[model samples]
Target chain A: MKHFSLRKLFLGCGALALFILAWKLVTDAKLVSPIFFPGPERTYAALVKGLSGGAMLSQTLETVQRMLLGWLLASFVGVFLGVLIGVSRRARAFIAPTLELLRPLPASAMIPIAIAFLGFSDNMVLVVIAFGALWPMLLATIHGFAAMEPRLYEVSALLGLSRAQVIWKLALPSAMPMILASLRLGLTISLILAVVGEMLASRQGLGQSILAASRSFRSPDLFAGIVILGAIGLVGSRLLSFAERRLLRWQAVSR
Target chain B: MVVTQLSTRPRHGEGNSTPASGEARIRIFDVTLSYGSLQIIGGISLDIAPGETICVIGPSGCGKTTLLRMLAGLARPTSGSVELDGSVLGGPNRSVAIVFQDYGKALLPWRTAAGNVSLALEARGCPGAERLAITREMLEKIGLGRHADKYPAEMSGGMQQRLQIARCLAQEPKVLLMDEPFGALDAMTRQALQDEVLGLVATTGATMVFVTHDLEEAIYLGDRIICLQPNPGRVGRIVDVRLARPRNQLLTRENPEFLRLRRELYDLIKDDHQ
Candidate 1:
């Protein structure tokens, strides 16, 4: 519940200003060729131009939409399977090793498989993104339920809770903090895979925009695309953290 | 011969239907618990009368909590049996409730005070419309009425324990098992809660099997105190509390009989540690 203090805010802003000054100096001195590395003003100008009712706006929205959808899909599949695997020792024993094997497979490795089935479509990109984002959530949820306090089992028994009641009323709430942390992790991966999938599949999104800009040596637009992506990441994480604060207030107000 | 003699009363199903008196009686028959050759409780037998409060005092590793868990049906005796109402207790019973020593882990952290209390009611399949009223009444009984909306993390240790007790009370349990519930609280809170618990027991007439490490808690709370020895835990001694009813915190402990019992029990437990 600690708010950002005025002094900390001032310090943060000051550091940003200093960084911008240093970037300007480097560009002016031509430390790197201006053709490859655009100056801040040029990047900013390109950003404004692209956002003000340009194709970049639609492209950015497409990327955000894809990221959110893929993340949601992975979340559903991950939690459903996670809970199934978590509550039963036999389920975990039988299926966990197979999941572990699939976990380490890279998203890039799955693109060809998705293309073979989906053929460079929106579905292909979503499949890639979901596959990449599923592990953190699944692993964290399984670990969360497994690491639960043993006392709760006794408490549940004494309360005469059924298996379903134990999972719903006892297990889910107990595993929430870990689940939330994993969800945040999953969200970041989802965004990364969304951008990668777009570039590889040639879908219309910020990823394709950046790829085209770099190939065409439109350095300003490329820089602008990178900046937009970073902004999206910041906003997505902020929204998630806000949700976390609201849901976890019980753990907070006590402190 | 070392058994604590069962206090006789009309048992359940004898047309005994009132909440003021006996509704259930617990009988432990040669209950022995062993974990893969590590003997915990060896051949322990006792009879708990309907509505009688029995406090078990023992040293560490004496299987006091183990014994209580058996009564709660959380753990099954390996070689022996626990019975209720003239039937062999199989699994957890709806009419049994337990208050653990570690109340922090016992309560749901995410739930409000009243919500936590409602968990027991929910398990009982109580009607949704009736849940709120019963939850409120249970809170009021344990003096947590004002803090109904607060979470367990927001409350003091004593209040959390009280909330746990309230949840158990909501079960309307015929048998309430406690495992040193106030062992972690401050002395003042512990004494206050003890009196409150006693008052609740007096009103509800529930059978209680309380496990504690403190001799005075056993003396102050029990109609009969069962002393247990460690290293293959078995009943060491059983003393009947002849002290007067409606026991006061100060007056009850000051009684010469209380001190004598405390001295005797202390030596009984102290020997096990050697």
Candidate 2:
């Protein structure tokens, strides 16, 4: 296992080196305009300057905070409604059609409507992010609960578990793997929506900084922001996986 | 092998107020189960005595599982009632537990052997302090003491089934309903589990209603065997297994009475199919 991970690490570093070398080559050969596409050194310099001056740091912190807040709210609402519909036939019949109808509408489409109602406030951006991230969590949770084996319910009933106990102990725990997977998907959506929301409606996040740098012809700052966004997504997903592994150790052992 | 004479005592509650020697622990009174218009179980009546291991044997569609479900209070009879301890059972209560056939599905994959057993104890409202001790004791009883920390997925089929049995036993049920508990096991594992179950029932004195399609298995573990006819299942025959207690696998199979019972049950099932 250690050797395999070491091999993977080597390959990952090799790929990154190749990408940076290609970027440097393109810049040296003047394949693209420097104004539009800066060199890796310039982008790295911008990143270091932003971090030292605390400008990019504050913007990144804002984006991270908004993303986490919106994602948490979405998770709570989505899981609540998902479990409700998943468990009850009447709830599913009544609510599923409406949810299905609304689910397909892109979160970006809601941006104009959100701006119209809430204007250029953090609340407007949060609304967009939360709305964007809710569907994956909701749908995955519903699928998880619905696909559970009937025998588990029978066992619960025979054991004389109360309805609440059955839902809490059996249904929720059984649906956890799917729920966690959906949460990971929601995290990606949350990040994307947070950036998009900031670019469109707010003035205080990495997305805004990237947009401002582009408008002012600061190519290195724009690329640095984009790179930072990518780094955030990568790190966030890795952290979630680490938590999933820890919490679901039984699943790992069982497999 | 010692030959124990079959008891011909009359069933309890015939005319006396005192609980008789063969007092019925569970009574199915003209129970019929249907799904919409499709009848799954036709009118069937049965009386199971305390500490008796009654096996229900039949063809595939013979509602053996349906009968067991009704007894477990997981399903209700369409026409009649199931009585436990002289009272009509309305729904699943603390007095009964079930061992399902598909151990893979029945036992929680997320829980260890001890944790799965603790699920039953938790449901029964056993205090937190006592749960660990009881869980360990139950697991040890099922010969899974060394593997208490293992999840169901890590265990072999036999081990998983034993874990499931241990979980049910942790419920401290007065009546245990098993629906083909060992049906998926290999021949050797099935035989071992069968003997283990017989020993458990003998020690616990719990009334058991085991459903299976294997005739020899029914005769080997059962005190009385109920054969059901299919296509709207109903009891076709009730055989009293007069074999002695603590039965040996080889000697019991070789016994003339065991062979006769097996043949009789096989003929009954064959006639039903015809």
Per-model CA lDDT versus the true structure: 0.87, 0.87
Q: Is the docking of candidate 2 incorrect, acceptable, medium or high quality?
A: medium
Q: List runs of model 1 lying over 4 Å from the truth.
A: A1-3, B1-24, B271-274
Chain B TM-scores of the candidates:
0.90, 0.91
Once fitted onto the true fold, the runs of candidate 2 whose alpha carbons sit more than 4 angstroms away are: B1-22
List the pairs of residues colliding in candidate 2.
Answer: none
Q: What share of the true interface contacts does each candidate keep?
A: 0.68, 0.75
RMSD of 1: 5.4
DockQ of each two-chain model = 0.69, 0.67
Give the per-residue lDDT of model 2 (tens digit) for A37-60: 999999999999998895999999
Which 10-residue window in model 1 chain B sums to the lowest lDDT? B9-18
lDDT of 2 at B113: 89
